[model samples]
Target chain A: MNESEKTRRKTRWFMLGAFVVAGAAFALIAATSMSKNLVYYWTPVDLYRAGNKAYGATIRLGGMVTPGSIKKLGGTAVEFDVHDATQHVHVKTSSVPPQMFRANIGVVVEGTMLRDGYFQSSRLMVSHNNEYKAPAKGHPVDQKTLRKMMESTEGIKD
Target chain B: MKTAWIFVVLGVAFLVAGSYLGLFVAPAEEYMGNVQRIMYVHVPTAWNWMLAVLYAFGAAIAFLFTANAKWDARLEAGLEVSTLLAFLLCCQGSIWAKPTWGVWWDWDPRLTSVAVLLFASIGIIALRGFVDDPHRRAVWSAVATIIASVDLPIVYYSVKWWNSLHQQQSSPQTVSSQFHLPLRLNAFGVLFLMIGFIMLRTRVANMNRARETALPPMTEHAGEIA
Candidate 1:
């Protein structure tokens, strides 16, 4: 083969080698980081299953607020029980809850589960299911009520 | 070129209108309150940057197939804009995240994927400068961009695929209509601005190519090589 052809063949091989090395490095980085950080919202049941592992580790607990579980504290602090049918957890937070925060709605709280058996939440988020509705034509509707109406009104006109 | 100015004017106008609606007209969000207004810009930037990256990815493929200089130019324009918007997205996300999440940043899946995407695009840009020969540079950069574009889907699906600090994707059904107007306005505003920038920037890339073509190839270092 001529000198130019030989040089071009070597360049192609080098390019392929570089591409493989880069791809491997990227995959390694992504896999390690993902394994370390992927924290799915855990149900109370998951927490129960987790046992000692759940304690002191930062977590996202998700479930419905039990009826009448809310206890108001001085200056925007509140404590409540979050439950999912079979399992339950006590949640405590100093930050004011969202306007739509109340009993029976699904809420996700992010914090650490203390060894004392309380979830000390630093952040709270309301989880709404996928549904849309035009504004209530007549009376103002509460968001929760709107969600209920949405569930029933599925397949019905807007 | 004259029409590009029109795009700029329209883009700026929509951006101003969107900001006005977000700041004064729209009611404060129930949960996040005033801080949610940042979404007007943040979401739009995120959308536009993805759009820009997709265009770059497409152009990169086209350049590979056709060996067209224009496609390479378009690819460069898209990469530059994508990088800028990715930076903006991170900044806006950080600001919004702080008050809401109680932290400035998290190594959550969604955030991490976006960081990776930004680094990939930046790497492609740097790759273009590292290679000397124009033909080789274009070919290798195009190949690199195509590979980097794989991260785009990973970024988009990161929240859904794994648990994340960021919320799931918001759609018309998911987002309340009350919050829709400014979001739509800002989305279009960024779209127009991105198009305008890419059009103007493509011309700049073309001029650069012309200058490069005029220069004697490798002449500056020929004596040293001898």
Candidate 2:
């Protein structure tokens, strides 16, 4: 091979070497982050074992908002208990609970760790189940539900 | 040499000062409270990644037009540094997302585009390195950067165009009139930090290239692998 061919070969190999290096870096990073999500998103078991350091630190709490535990105090203020199988947590907030946050369903709360050791949520999401529905065909729209949803949209900019 | 040192010192000092300003001085946001402090890391990281991509684009264009090896070297440096910075950005953003969005990752516009940008840029740089002809490498990577950069605005507005959990980025003066000056200073500090990183990274690329050019032909030492 000529001198140019040889150099080109080296450049190609060098680039290959770089990809090998970067791919490994990306894999390592991905694994670490996934592990952290599992480890740091404290479960009821983990939190109880360590006296709930998980509370009061910003976290995403996921559990079932217990059935009878939900109470409407006044206006938008609703209080409920979020429960895993083992331990349960008290949640206080004043906003519309997501449509999916039905009795004994999964919910995730995001926010800071309060001094009182509660997951003082700044954001809440009711888990959307990975369920599939058949495509709507001839079913007529429910007029009453449509009217109710329209009425609710008057004040919400979002 | 003196200019390099000046940047290094400034980078360190501004990093320290900016940390203090964002962490200590800025009042806790009324809603998110101290969890909002994560913004200091997230915003800067995202900003730095953007700047790094810009640097790569500028270097690529320069190399294409000037046909100078130095511009090629600069383009290589920008890509390397930007890739690492993009890695950091993904990490820090994951941390921030958990506190705000209740998930480590989301498949939304800002995020989806950034991922595409990172992967596409990596591909461009890889293609550049694979081609032995210096001119070809420069031209191809330059074209790649321009194409990749076109997606940046699309990524920036992704959240707005879609009904996404990611909130609208707060304008500087929107929070308080007092935030304007401090935020600008903070942005300036981020710019300086990026400049320093890019310069350092580019020097490394130059050294690697020099090493490649200076080495004797393969036949001269036929058995040895560099």
Best by TM-score: 1
Worst 10 residues of 1 chain B by lDDT: B159-168
Give the DockQ of candidate 1.
Answer: 0.16
Q: How does residue B158 of candidate 1 score in lDDT?
A: 72
Q: Score candidate 1 by TM-score against the native.
A: 0.74
lDDT of each: 0.76, 0.60
Q: Which residue pairs overlap in candidate 1's backbone?
A: none
iRMSD of prediction 2: 15.1
Q: Report chain A TM-scores, every model.
A: 0.61, 0.65
Per-model TM-score of chain B: 0.95, 0.84
**Tens-place lDDT digits, model 2, residues A1-158:** 97756644654454444445545655554465446432313434445666555545666555556678888869866778776656777777665565335555456566655667455665675542211112234642245533332222111221
Error of 2 at A154 (Å): 14
Model 2 complex DockQ against the native: 0.04
**TM-score result, candidate 2:** 0.57
Q: Where does candidate 1 stray beyond 4 Å? A: A1-41, A55-86, A91-115, A119-158, B219-226
